[model samples]
Target: MDYAKTERADALAAGYVAGTLRGPARRRFEALLPGHPALRAAVRDWQDRLMPLTASLPPVAPPPHVWAAVERQLWPTVAAAAPSPWWQRLAPWRALSGLALVAVVGLSVLLATPPPAQAPVVVVLQSTGKDPAVAGSLVASFSGDGRAVVARPITPVAVTTDRALELWWAPLEGKPTSLGLIRADGVTVLSRGRLPGGLRGSGIDHMAVSVEPPGGSPTGQPTGPVVFYGKLQL
Candidate 1:
């Protein structure tokens, strides 16, 4: 959609940050973010601007219908059994109150924890020649929703000011796509939509990293030798 070039980018980014964008639309918007720094910056700005308002709001009990909607989201099978309005007496909101408590607790846990690192599918990247166990070992994992990928270094890997470490995904059958540039020590989170088809399911064959001119490869293709390579696993 070339959302990066359009006015809708701001609006879409706002919705994405607000937790209002959902399903495929949300995923699609996330996919667009990597190539557009301005959109990513706008989203970060919105998040910074909105978080305080969100935190300041008083917690209120949700209306009954809201619980119904949540049930539908959390348990579609349970929701479909009645096929009637949840307000109906026979629908038994009383009995479901206990289930609601469980739901609430579950939701709280989900909210309190970081999403990506929780039992994340991992890829272990190893550099060639030297001990694979030594410096330059990296771990790659995905967010619970598969909307982001995090790469964390287990050991040091050097990069000069004129160069950067760039990550890439090689799908089973297509050209590699840049995930993003990452740091050597700290964690780098790449917010993205669902991975390319080749990289998802069983289509992902490998992941690789290369040293590139500062900022990243300019031609959208790796211009330097791959320094680390790994088989991607879910």
Candidate 2:
């Protein structure tokens, strides 16, 4: 592959930075970066473009068990202390009441069920603005079964109370269709019932997020500026 080509490099770098290029493909891209200056430049450009999206995200502390596991790996001898008695460790169980225990069991059963045969499709919607402070990004994942989609903001988006963020499925040759109104600060799930048919087909060209009224576009089309947009890889 000619990594020097701008179009090819940009596409691969975008996927790499967005975390959609994974496993062997990701490793292969990294290996080529050292030998290809254009590829390296593309990667740097993408990092600069997408890194700002994390500015509004608050720091999250890891769980206690995660730290404990790290400490065990770092100092095995120190972590080999005697296990506490069952009664002494009751504190953890106290948080899991009878109802919670039943819920956990039900979740375990659900998890044991087989996953969808197809792999999920992931898209990274990048901000269209040049300013980092005002720009935002979002990651959207379509379930393998094509029955649902989960949209999550990379950072909190500031919007007036009267305005809202809306997702759209833009086709190759026509006006975009509204997927649904999405949140600016949290994950939003759109079920199959909420979505129109032919999502898994080739009719759709790309996905976009547009700023709109609180209840979404009154005209069944985007009324506000398109703040973020991305191409569909499917």
Best by lDDT: 2
lDDT of each: 0.69, 0.76
State in Å the error of residue 165, model 1. Answer: 0.4
Q: Identify the runs in model 2 with alpha carbons over 4 angstroms from their true place.
A: 1-14, 17-29, 32-116, 130-134
lDDT of 2 at 56: 48
Model 1 residue 52 lDDT? 48
Model 2: number of clashes? 0
Model 2 lDDT, residue 124, Cα:
80
lDDT by residue (tens digit), candidate 1, 1-234: 665653456556656765656799988878878988878976886566445433533455666889989998999998888666444544477758866887999899889965432333456576753323223556676544445788877557766677788888877788888889988878898867637532354366788888788879999998987888876545
True-vs-predicted CA distance for residue 8, candidate 1, Å = 52
Clashes by residue pair, model 1:
none
User: Model 1 residue 67 lDDT?
Assistant: 94
The positional error of residue 48 in candidate 1, measured at the CA in angstroms, is 32
lDDT accuracy of residue 122 in candidate 1: 57
What lDDT score is found at residue 51 in candidate 1? Answer: 52
